[model samples]
Target: MKKIALILLVFMASAACKTNPFTGKKMLNFYGNSQIFPTAFAQYDQFLNQNKVVETGKDAQMITNVGQRIASAAERWLSANGYPGYLKDYKWEYNLVQDETVNAWCMPGGKIVFYTGILPITQTETGVAVVMGHEVAHALADHGAQRMSAGTLQQLGAVAGNVAIKDERTRNTFNQAYGLGSTVGVMLPFSRSHETEADRIGLQIMAIAGYNPDEAANLWRRMKAKSGGQAPPEFMSTHPSNDTRINNLTAWAPMARQEAAKFGVTSFK
Candidate 1:
């Protein structure tokens, strides 16, 4: 049973790979847009219905405007790079929700929400572009589907271990060790890599949209300050540390600007 399970896992992984055009890397993704998008859209609708969605306000309008521009930039980049229909399945929607969470997020198929509390950090429209770009990048990269795929594989690995171990005590021990080891060694690092990828992609798209890429790093600095230096160690955390993000964004800003120049955008906002 264990051997069969291992074989099945390997087969699935080999067959379920998709190439991410932006990164030009093949990633494991068991779920397709058809399967993930509808569910995400439904959940997003439910959340908006449950929350206080600010429909008529300056901040709300700004969120929509920045989101549309960033998304358009991404589409332009994709079309120019030979993936003309990459975003065809994506139904883009952005809304501002009245909340104090100090965060924003995007669903799989371009559903985005900005919490009111994050406006202070994103003080200007350019600053808002920084955050909007990051969130949109996650959807563009299909990080949510990748994460689900990874989780499925992680569970299968544990199941294989359990089936292979004959002794009950040994099986229990393997489960505990596998849970911790897989999370820290594989899952956490995977998540961190996704975050880093999003940051880089976001910077490029925001720049193409005539927003300053340098502000990406500055946004992270403000994020660090807001966190009060309280965060888990890098290895244990799902996202990269604030300092790491700041440094990465700073280094990538020039390249982003170069990319924007290809689209005839030289002056940033």
Candidate 2:
């Protein structure tokens, strides 16, 4: 049984490896991009049809404008990094919904929805760019794909472990091991890395889009205040803590500004 378990683990580890595009880190991602992209596109369309998508107007126009700038920045960054036409599969669209929820999200295929309540906090076009760039960075970095891959491995490991164990005590031990390995070795660090990468890429994108990267720090301050000090610690949540995020963004802003200078955006106001 021990030999069989060890062999299975070895196979799983060998079969699940991938490399993160931005960080160049070796990771375990079992899902293929070809499989995930089409499904994400279909889901995005379905969501647009079902939701109250805002039409042409001030708020709607602002969303679309900021989204386009960010999308252009992403395309430029990818192309410069030798991934030309990387965004060909993306059908980007942005909308502001009438809801009061202070929430926003960028879906897998570049669909973005910004709830009206978030606008008050965003305050200006640059602030909106900060939030939109961060959300868009998540999609570009393929964090969703990584998360799905991690979930698949966790499920498969549990099933294999259950099949290998005979006694209830051994089964429980196997289950615990599977859970700990999946959560600690796979999920937690991956999530934190994604958050940090998103902040880095998002700052660059916003700066290239002609929005001041400094706004990212202020945006997180607003997010923290809006949360009323009610969020879980950085380790316990998918997002970094407010202070950590703000500090990281502050440190990265000058670098982003430097990168933007190469793109003819010397000043962002």
Candidate 3:
């Protein structure tokens, strides 16, 4: 079992290397859109049906518009970089849900949802664009699939450990330790890296979509103020602190504009 686990890990690491065009980094993604998108689409549909989805309103329209523009901008960037039709398989859909959670998320294959609670934080259309771009970036980067693949490997490791450890008490102790160690040391950091990457990539796409990349930082500032400095420590959490994101976005705003210039987008709203 141990040998099999090692072999599987090696195979996945070598065979599942997918190059993320925007970042120039090779990501480990064992599942493709074909495998993941349908599930995400179905789940999204189910959620929409179960929840109070705001289907017709100015806010709803604005959410869809920004999401579409961000997705288009992402496609333009990809096509310009010699990866045309990269999003052809994506069935993009954006919706606004009537919730007070102050959250927005994008699923695999471009399914996005924005909660009503976030609208106040995104005070303007441009602010909406900032949030939309970040969510769209997650879809474009195949983060959902990558996370699923990573989770699979983590479970496999646990199974291998259980099978190899014949002492029942020792195995139980190992499981407890391994769970904490892997989650904090590996999974949390991995998730934080994805969030940071999404922030950078989202900034560029929002700029190209004619939204001010500088607003990305401002949005985080609002988010920070809204949170009231009550968040888990960065090292212990799966997300970077609001302050870290604010600083990173501020520094990257100029570069995002430079990227927008390459696509003939000189002015931003």
Off by over 4 Å in 2: 1-19
TM for candidate 2 is 0.88
How far off is residue 189 in model 3, in Å? 0.5
Model 3 TM: 0.98
Give a tens-digit lDDT track for model 1, residues 60-114. Answer: 9999999999999999999999999999999999999999999999999999999
Please provide, for model 2 over 115-227, each residue's C-alpha lDDT reduced to its tens digit, 9 standing for 90 to 100.
Answer: 88899889999999998998898888777877777676677667777877789998998788878877877678778888888889889999999999999999889989999
Q: Give me the overall lDDT of model 1.
A: 0.96
Model 3 per-residue lDDT tens digits across residues 223-252: 999999999889999889999999999999
Q: Which stretches of candidate 1 lie over 4 Å from their true place?
A: none
Report, for every candidate in turn, its global Cα lDDT versus the true structure.
0.96, 0.82, 0.92
Model 1 residue 127 lDDT? 96
TM-score of each: 0.99, 0.88, 0.98
lDDT of 3 at 238: 82
Candidate 2 local lDDT, residue 105: 84
Residue pairs with backbone atoms closer than 3 Å in model 3 (clashes):
none
List clashing residue pairs in candidate 2.
none
